[model samples]
Target: MYLTSKVVIEKEKIKKPRGLQNTLHDDYVKCKEECRKIEEREITEKYIQYLKTELEAAELVVAQESAALQATSIVSSNNQNENKLDQVPSEDSILKSEKETFVQEENLIV
Candidate 1:
């Protein structure tokens, strides 16, 4: 789906062959092969570019979803923490109850 190498595509050397000579069939065949190679490289480069763009869009969607998930988790955790705080007694109330228990224990000892 995407390019594996950091460098996208290697540039092919543009061959500037002179006008085709029709004396021999071999020369014509060679020219056709060269043209085919040029077309192949052109299409290959365009396909690679298309793949790169699709990959970029996919990455962006993944990033956005990940951020949304993290935000939801954070808000859920904060809500849990707030609920815990509400359920727990204050420090001063805990201390006052402990002192009253201590006094009762002391009287019972006496």
Candidate 2:
């Protein structure tokens, strides 16, 4: 009876790998590889996001410099305009002053 039981147990163990469960191990390995690929993809996406953020920050810095340059140009133009206005004389006052000088010189000569 003990020998018969041992034979039966070995026969049952032999039947464990029939059709359906044979590929289960292969499928598990494939699934593990797929999970690893997914992890790599997520890491690449995060790196792309970091680069995009850095690009946006660099663009903002360029915009700020452009604005500063524009402001400086405007201030310089305004100063030049003010200086030009100070140097320019009214037309009527210049003619009247010239006429008085001519009359005074003529009277002195006479």
Query: Which candidate leads the pack in lDDT?
Result: 2
Instruction: List ranges where model 1 is wrong by over 4 Å.
Output: 1-24, 85-110
Per-residue accuracy of model 1 over 61-98 as CA lDDT, tens digit each: 99999999999999999999999888979899999999
Provide the global lDDT of candidate 2 against the true structure.
0.91
Residue 79, candidate 1: alpha-carbon lDDT: 97
- Residue-by-residue lDDT tens digits, candidate 2, 26-97: 788889999999999999999999999999999999999999999999999999999998886789889999
State the displacement of the C-alpha of residue 15, model 2, in Å, after optimal TM-score superposition: 16
Instruction: Give the TM-score of each candidate.
Output: 0.53, 0.54
Relative to the unseen true structure, what is the C-alpha lDDT of residue 64 in candidate 1, on a scale of 0 to 100? 99
| Each model's lDDT | 0.85, 0.91
